[model samples]
Target: MLKIEGLSKTFGKGTLNEKKIFSNFNFNVDNGDFITIIGSNGAGKSSLFNAIFGTFLPDEGRIYLDNKDITYVPSHVRAKDIGYLFQDPRVGTAPNMTIEENLFLAAGEGGWFSIGQKKKSNEFKEKLSLLNMNLENNLKKPVGLLSGGQRQALTLLMATYSKPKLLLLDEHTAALDPETAKKVLDLTNKVVKEEHLTCLMITHSMESALSHGNRIIMMNDGQIIYDAKGKEKEEQTVQGLLNLFKTKEGNLMASDRMLLEV
Candidate 1:
């Protein structure tokens, strides 16, 4: 459903600290595809998401969603069709707002007039109950008062409330504890499948990359070193992926965080 052609981006151009992120990059994401992306530091994984979501205009290339070019679309405009979840749970939510208020905004009903409406409140409670986090009874509690996992779960629900065409998850569970992360990931899978949404997730865990998505892509130096799906992806193992990276890049991945976390 998304196509990126001849994409390129660079930062600090023409200066001593210049860095080139992408050069003539091309990628295509099929509809309903859940793609897991893994790469070392400076591999442009998050940059790819930023480019697609219009966080910054690419120096060159065209980005198309559903056959319509959106290369120059402003980030705010793209926000209507794209849902992005950051690693930090605090990034997308209003800390001081009550849980109900936040959901009220995400649901896009109207304004404060729509906040306590019985019908809308009931719907929000029903959705919250599905989270099984006892959040339905905490509607009046400030989001900042919730635990990290709880806040992240709430953010996930808010992002998907309107069903965007694509969801971008940038190491969304990287900040949580193991058990909490698992819970969040399980909820993520459930939501994506039930909504039939296309998704791209950047993760540090090799096991997560292999197990969670239908397709797995390994990137390095701003290029896709490996792309596998279906039977090929299912057959890949963590050790095999490490060997492939060593063969292609002449060494194991250089990121300490990636190595340690996986």
Candidate 2:
């Protein structure tokens, strides 16, 4: 239930350093659609999320969520409708805040601690218990003390704590070890399925994009160049997709590990 029409952005306008990030970008996300965005560095994958999440207002274009124009909506206001998790797990949780406390303050659902003792601890414990990862017992633990995977999984829970309409994951598993990343990715998939959350996930690893999401989109020069889903994506190898880019859009040089990581 999101749409982007004629979206474009550029930096350093009217100067020798001018760089245009995207041009006439367009895409529509369906209810519960899990879209994996894959592209190399400087490809505008993260920029697109920032643009959508209100971190950066594009020089031009319109962003709509459920048909309401949110082009100028401040990031804080948009937080109620959209959730973003950065590549760094630390970005999602407050290290100094206890697990229950962090969830308590998420999206401003509870009263201020001084207003009245918020009674969310029990409800939050029940929710965390569903993770089957012992996070329920660590409700009072500082998020910074968690392992990378745990923090990422907890961040997943935090992003959805308020049930935002859409979730934006920007290379959320990149920093973890392969095993930890897989665990976090699995947690992400489970949560999305359980909640029926519509999501946009940016990733460099083609394997991840193909393995986890229902759809995969290939982007270049700040525009979507290839879009496929489900069985359509299943038949192709990662190398096949890379070659397709070569044939259709010319060679795009990205890291070898990035190609292999997914």
Candidate 3:
């Protein structure tokens, strides 16, 4: 349901600090297609999401969602159909607000997820209980008091409160503990399957990239070097992906591949 064509971007152009982040990077996702993106730092993975979300304008490119020209739609309007979860959970919520208040914002003012129409009562509490988290007992508590895992879980719920057409997860589990990260990842898989949400997640975990999404895109030097799906992807290994990256660029760094928690 989303399409990116010839998306390109650069930082510090026209000077010694000039760097080209994207060079005709193109990608697309069908409805209900959970695509996982993998690449090293500065692979233009996050930049691609920003361009698609309208947070940054591509120097020259176009993005379309379900055939509509969203290249210049601006972030607020784009938020109606897209959800973004950054590496930091704090980026998604108002830390000073109580859990209840934060969720109220997620329910939105008049948007699809808005809770303004309903009195903030037992109903919201009931929904929070479904998370199987004790959050239901602490609606009045400031979110800052919660652990990183709890915050990230709540953030995931808030992101999907309105059921956006596309979900962008930028290293959402990178900051959590191994156990917590697995928990969040499990919740993520559940949410995507249950909602049939079209998602694009950038992860350093090779196992996660292969095992979770229906398709995987491997990017290098701003271009998609590898793309595979279903049965083809089931045969992949972390070392295999590393070898491919090395074969293309002749080396792989310790920073590129994730350590298997097992």
Candidate 4:
């Protein structure tokens, strides 16, 4: 479970370029809750994740995971409980490293000195097999040589290998072609379900936001403008969400990427 209380963040504060991103933003995520987040550009979606991950300190507020405050915790410390997948496949992986090697580092976060101590273990192979991407057979292959879809699939496996308390997916499938994106999304859904992981995924597709998670949230300006769950969320459609956004923001939705993708 996670709770964000009265969170606030600003950029270029106390200067001519001062811009507030979050003004007393508040949100709570329940245990094993899979939440998909959607918002226009500058909706504070990335800022929210950055604040939660300790990429930067929030101006004011507290973030609690399973009742422990982690607002100011160092990113590396938080990495133990949080697994993040970036939009760019190249970001989360060591390109020069073999697929199995990258996973070894992920499984042993603080054991970097033991990097060369082990090769691909049966357990690692077993996990890769679940992806159905045939990566298990190429464990020794360099990650950089794989296709974007393949690399992203490997990154997802590495990120979830330890079953962290929370998984942050920052449009992890956005970079792939439509077919590859669908495959990656399917793999993501499978992994999340099998692990029963609490997840927060930011997506640019209304169809993706509505189709994947049990809960859907819409962000606007600096705060959560709409939150839907259970049957409410199940009943939602892409058109309905777009209409809701227009109603709440009193302006046309601005993200051309989202519109075109949907």
Candidate 5:
């Protein structure tokens, strides 16, 4: 469960380039809710995640997770309860490290130190096996040698190994080919359901937003312009969502990436 109230963020404040991103933005996410977020470029989708992840302090307002305030909590402190997968696969992994080594570090989150002796545990192997990518046999292989999809899958596994309270997916599959993206998305869905994790995913594809999550949110000009859930979300088609965006914002959806994905 996450709640944000009166959240405001601005960059280059009081200068010629002063541009406000969020103006009293407010949102609430329920426990175990899988929410897909969509918007054109500069809709503040990534900024919203950055604020929640404590990448920087917001100018005002508060954030709470499971009823505990974490607005000003440092990113390292929040890392234990939050799992983040970046759009770039390389960003989330240590390229020089072996696959098992990376996973060992992930599993040891919130710990002061990790014992190298435990890297070969059956638990680790079992988890790797679930990927169905034959990564279990390549534990000693460097992560840099993996394909894009394989590395992303490993990152997903590492991120969820501890079953954090929330998972933040920032276009995690956008870098892959269509088929590979679908595989990764399927794996993501499987893991999220198995863990019953609360998730917030930012995606450019209208089809992805409508197809994956139980809830869909549209952002425009730094505010949530539309939010749909349950039957409303289930009944939505890509064309209908595009029409809704046009109706709400009185402008055509203008992202080439989003348009092409649909």
Candidate 6:
């Protein structure tokens, strides 16, 4: 469903601070695939998502979604086809907007007149009720008033409300407390499974990577070092992944946060 070919990206190209992220990277994601990606800092995971989402175009290569080339598409235009959830709950939401208003915008239906329509509003409540966050009754409250976990849950609902062709989750639960993070993760899995979303998630926790998703990929220096799926992914353990990286990608340092999580 998604393909990247000959992708290359560099920051401050040809300057003293020039840094290369991706280099001739090529990968394919099948329809209905849920991929969990794990790597240390500066591994190009976020850059890959940005390149696909058109936050910035890759210096080389083409990105195709459902066989349509979207490499040069503007981010706002791509936003319709691709849903992205950032690590920061505040990033994707309008802090001052009421929850109802935010959902109205995310639904992308009629104008302001449609906001309070009973039919659409009921649908919103049904969706919100699934989060079990007591948000359904507080639709008029500003999103800024919600907790971190609640805001992230709302963002997840917004991102998937349209059932976009692809979803990119960038360490979306990393900011929440452990209990809250797990709750959000459970909610995320529910949304992705129910929607049958083709998703790629970047995570620092090895346990989460192994437990979630149909497939797992290990990335380093903009390269995919390992890819596992099905029985292989199920058989893997968190420590095993760490050992593999240590033995196979010698001298590469996983972030302290990653190590601690394991």
Query: Per-candidate TM vs. native?
Result: 0.97, 0.92, 0.92, 0.94, 0.94, 0.96
lDDT of 5 by residue, 187-243 (tens): 999999999999999998999889897999999889998899999999999889778
Query: For residues 16-101, could you state the per-residue lDDT of candidate 6 as single tens digits?
Result: 99999999999999999999999888888999899999988889999999999998889999999999999999988899999988
lDDT against true structure, model 1: 0.91
Tens digits of lDDT, candidate 1, 1-262: 9999999988899999899999999999999999999988878899999999998889999999999999999999999899999999888889999999999888876775754578888899999999988999999999999999999999999999999999999999999999999999999999999999999999989888888879999988899999999999999998888888888878774563473365
Off-target runs (Cα >4 Å) in candidate 1 are 253-262
- Local distance difference test values of all predictions, in order: 0.91, 0.83, 0.85, 0.88, 0.89, 0.91
lDDT of 3 by residue, 134-195 (tens): 88899989999888888988999999988999999999999988888998898899989998
| lDDT score for residue 116 of model 1 | 57
Q: List the residue pairs that clash in candidate 5.
A: none
* Candidate 6, residue 15: lDDT: 100
Which pairs clash (backbone N, Cα, C closer than 3 Å) in model 6? Answer: none
After superposition, which runs of candidate 6 have C-alpha atoms over 4 Å from their true positions?
252-254, 257-262
Q: How much is the lDDT of residue 11 in candidate 3?
A: 81
Question: How do the residues 200-222 of candidate 2 rate in per-residue lDDT, one tens digit apiece?
Answer: 99887888888877888988778
- TM-score for model 4? 0.94
Locate the minimum summed-lDDT window of 10 residues in model 1. Answer: 253-262
Segments of candidate 5 deviating more than 4 angstroms? 109-120, 253-257, 260-262
